[model samples]
Target: MKKNTLTFIFAVGALIFFSQLSAQENPLSVGFKAGTGLSNYRLSGDMKSFTSKMSIGGSVGGFVKYDLSSNFALQSGIDLYYSTSKLDSKVDKSSNKLKSLGVEIPLYGIVQGKLGSGKAFIGAGPYVGYGISMKSNGVNLFKNSNEAGKLVMNRFDYGLGGIAGYDFDKNWQINASYQLGIADLLKGKGGSMKNHGISVGIAYKF
Candidate 1:
């Protein structure tokens, strides 16, 4: 029994050591990640102050990384982003919720370094999103808001984001990021509503 236990321990140690070595040698990788997180927009308009609740949201996506040197790489990907937030107004006695579905593309300039048996990285860059659909309280907000039936939101959104992460092994990693919307979503309205949120997720490399 003691011999069998010793063998198992050695095997685990060997597996970890080799995994680290393999990661160091590889300069390029592709991976997929999926996770849920909290989301809320930077509100505007007269009722913007009433926005209080953050909605739960998530993304499923894949990324590609290409090393530029020992300490830098370019990372980019497409992610399916879904987010919602709740708005309540006491003065008007109104409660409403906003939801959006979009596809996002991000290009990050990442700096990577070795951290003990793993690797760590930090990145920041610009991102763009195109909305697939948007709604408020089960009503299509993209539809006519005026008597002429014109769209209210500009479908394109652009932002900046920062990310930091650690890769535990060649195949597993965890990351967190924050995004700030730079472009207004309002078509021609005076008020400004922008997207901004943070996300944490796990990724697997192939």
Candidate 2:
């Protein structure tokens, strides 16, 4: 687990470095995005005593995108994201809305084409997020364990995600994105968990 986390961090640094080198030759754009995110955990492995609820959160980030061609480009950025969900434990007769804060590295492959007065585009790629903190009803839940049934949270996560948006003009755009979490976020034994996050919002280019 430590190796994986270190590798992920190294990869993020390498990507940003390469993007910087490419910026000199390619048409590059720097942008900021802000939006609302909806997250839900898919539970598995005999969840006979728990109930799950969807959480709504917010996301804000900046990105650097380099155009490889008129129709293709690559974008990567750092984002701070948040999520909170209610977990009901029937066995313990307890319930709490757990909140988590995390940072993400998003790499997107963008495809573009011209539309009436603007551009229409779509992108798909991968993302890695690391948990910074977690709390349930204001109590810390970070046990730093990945074993099942420990009721602890995992700090590392990686997944495939995609984005689609419309560039209204050169400086502004509207977009929607989704992440299909491929990692197990729960380290406890009773069940496994996968996260699904969706968001919609606006972006600005500079």
Q: Which window of ten consecutive residues has the lowest lDDT sum in model 1?
A: 142-151
C-alpha lDDT of candidate 1 relative to the true structure: 0.84
Residue-by-residue lDDT tens digits, candidate 2, 90-159: 7887877879899999899999989999999999999999999988755566765444444677889999
Candidate 1 per-residue C-alpha lDDT over 1-206 given as tens digits, one digit per residue, 9 for 90 to 100? 99999999999999976565567577789999987888776867743646647889999999999876667889999999898887676577677777889999999999999998999999999999999989875667766576452237778999999999999988999999999999988676656678888899999997
Lowest-scoring 10 consecutive residues by lDDT in candidate 2? 142-151
Regions of candidate 1 where Cα sits further than 4 Å from its true position? 1-24, 45-49, 147-151
Which pairs of residues collide in model 1?
none
All predictions: root-mean-square deviation over Cα? 13.0, 10.0
* Cα-based TM-score, every candidate: 0.81, 0.80
Per TM-score, the best of the predicted structures is: 1
Q: Distance from true position, residue 180, model 2, in Å?
A: 1.0
Clashing pairs in 2: 147-187, 148-188, 148-189, 149-188, 149-189, 150-188
- Computed on alpha carbons, the lDDT of every model, listed in order, comes to 0.84, 0.84
> Model 1, 19: alpha-carbon shift in Å?
24
